[model samples]
Target: MSRPLVIDEAEVEITAIRAQGAGGQNVNKVASAIHLRFNIAASSLPDDVKARLLASRDSRITQGGVLVLKAQRHRTQELNRLDALARLHELVQGVAQPPRARKATRPTRGSQLRRLAGKSRRAVVKAGRGRPDLS
Candidate 1:
């Protein structure tokens, strides 16, 4: 099992926004949604972790280097806020784990021979598909 991640609550900014879409009168009247924003460039994260987080292709991360997460699934404002912060913690933890470096390797002699043999077989099959010479 993975360890529980502890994110500094001070790093994230949470704002209450009206939930979008069809909620009838309740949507406009109640501010039961949350908008969580974390500035990647200005965070107190390690340099390598910050770089990795910024390089991530997550849709939540905007072009301005801000991680924006909307939490409107829950009915309560506090729940939504917690949900957004949890998501942010998950995102940070994802980048916190460093990836293993890929070792450079060359194809084995048997694999190379098999590839060349497959190519030769394909060429022969294509050559056979052409019209045969009579003369």
Candidate 2:
């Protein structure tokens, strides 16, 4: 098993912004949403992890190598901040371990024969669905 990745809190940039949607009167007055930006190129993560993160297909990752996350699910700034941090941690953990290399193997003779038998049986069943022969 690979070791867990630890991201420095200081490395993450968090900003408070007003969430969009119907939030009554408090929505206009308070900034409860959190905007997070993490620069993969500047982070202290491992080389492979950094490479994987940069190469990820997530649209949030920009050409400048910065990952942008918006957390507005919660009603409070603190909750949104935590949500953003959790998401960042999840993303990092996902690519922390390298995928296992696959070994190639061929089908056994018995299995091949069984597959052929199943195919022939299916063919017979399908053929039976054709028009009946009228004498």
Candidate 3:
């Protein structure tokens, strides 16, 4: 998120294919869906970004480091292509920034004392319900 990275169209392989599912008769007749594939290894993205992307373990990514996406949400071919590109950008951006290192922390003294005090109050209530001195 620090810097927006641009993906060149040449790096992506987009193909038009028929969209599956319910649609007037046009679904079977028109190739309105788009199949997009981008090879992370061959992209111009930063080396660190590429490494993280490949290590992401996303099922959409093939063993060869290719990201495959299918966009058929839109009825138009152009819209579907744009949708696929947008999704690709989103994926690349997700892995662009490295994760921040975690810092070790400990509970404050006041919090520790407050927890013990609550436990003592509960114990007294439970003990009162147990027996009437059995006398």
- What TM-score would you give candidate 2 relative to the actual structure? 0.82
The predicted structure with the larger lDDT, 1 or 2, is 2
Residue 129 of model 3: what lDDT?
Answer: 91
lDDT (C-alpha) at residue 19 in model 2: 92
Q: After superposition, how far is residue 78 of candidate 3 from its true place, in Å?
A: 0.1
Local accuracy by lDDT, each model:
0.88, 0.95, 0.95
User: Mind giving the per-residue lDDT tens digits that candidate 1 earns over 1-135?
Assistant: 445446677878889999988888989899999998899898888788889999989898899999999999987899999889888888888878888899999999999999999999999999999999989
Pick by lDDT: 1 or 3, better one: 3
Tell me how far the alpha carbon of residue 52 in candidate 2 is from the true structure, in angstroms, after superposition.
1.6
Structure candidate 1, residue pairs in collision: none
lDDT of 2 by residue, 1-135 (tens): 777899999999999999989898778889999999999999999999999898889999999999999999989999999999999999999999887899999999999999999999999999999999998
- Runs in model 2 deviating more than 4 A are 125-135
Candidate 3: the clashing residue pairs are none
Query: Against the correct fold, how does model 1 do in TM-score?
Result: 0.86
TM-score of each: 0.86, 0.82, 0.79
lDDT of 2 at 93: 99
For all candidates, the clash counts are 0, 0, 0
